[model samples]
Target: MNLLHIDSSILGDHSVSRKVSAAAVVAIVAANPGVKVTYRDLDAAPAPHQSGALLAARLLDPGARSADQARDITEADAVLDEFLAADIVVIGAPMYNFGIPSTLKSWIDHLAIAGKTFSYSEAGVQGLAGGKRLILASSRGGFYGADSPMAAVQHQESYLRDFFRFIGIPDVEVVSAEGVNYGPDHKQKALDGAVAEAANLGRALQAA
Candidate 1:
């Protein structure tokens, strides 16, 4: 199986989402022996944010693109191709100000291509990228679940879930550590719980 693991946290070693995502990948590898995993750290190498020049480059003929535009287009295509080739995708997404990191959003912009990941049809919209599993390791500074007081403002996971669904991936699983910035004790407990959840999911995948 081909697995694509993407980590978007800027915190590097101090990132709980990274720890959870890595643990999940290990579990997947353990369960499916010899599974090929490709890892990308968005913080280390981030995709270019969409811009007018990038958009123009995409719409223009390849031969007409400027050197920089050509390079940007090529990079975007590579990101899309990598995502399309993956059977399983694991994402480490940390909440930033009640939303996902900009780097992660930039990565998504590269993948959500027309007539590639999705297409318009007589039936409305059709998603081309289906039959794949997506696992998200999310870290948040505050509680944002349905029961939380800030639930209404929780765009991190909710936005991700909707984005995936729009692209034809409806069955996304999230292992999250919330309230991490509440206190040192809360942070430790949240991390511990999220790590355990990731490990358990990995074991279950292996058993399956």
Candidate 2:
């Protein structure tokens, strides 16, 4: 199976989400030998934020596109194609100010193309890209569980989950390492729990 692994954290080596995501990838690869793994680090190479110019470039003939427009549109198409080709996708999403990184959001905008990923009519919206597994390696400095008093202010995981669902991936799995900034003990405990869950998820993928 093809696996697409993405990391959006700008924290580099100190990123908790990156660590958790790497562990998940390692576990998945160990369980399923010969799985083709493709990786993208959004922080290292980010997609340009969506803009009117981007739309214009898409509308223009390929031969007429300027160098920069060609480059941007090409990357956008490549991102969408990668998601379509992947059987399983794992993405690292660290909460920043209660939301996701702008780079990650930019990547997602590429995948949410009408007709390519979804369709809507009088019958309502229908997702075209179905049957792919999505795993989110999430991290946050604060507690925002469903029962937490701060849940209402949380938009990271919830936004991602809803967005994926809108694109036709109905089952979104998450392995979260939260409260990392609380203290050393909280961070270690959260990492341990998330790693264990990631391993279990990897094993399940092997069975599938």
Best by lDDT: 2
| Model 1: CA > 4 A from native | 206-208
- Report how far off residue 93 is in candidate 1 (Å): 0.6
Cα RMSD for predicted model 1: 1.6
lDDT of each: 0.90, 0.92
For model 2, the stretches where C-alpha displacement exceeds 4 angstroms are: none
Cα-based lDDT at residue 45, candidate 1 = 92
Q: Write the per-residue lDDT of candidate 1 for residues 133-179, one digit (tens) a residue.
A: 89999999988999988999999999999999989999899999998
How much lDDT does candidate 2 score? 0.92
Candidate 1 lDDT at 208 equals 27
| TM match of model 1 to true structure | 0.94
- Model 1: ten consecutive residues of lowest lDDT: 199-208
Q: What C-alpha lDDT, on a 0 to 100 scale, does residue 127 get in candidate 1?
A: 82
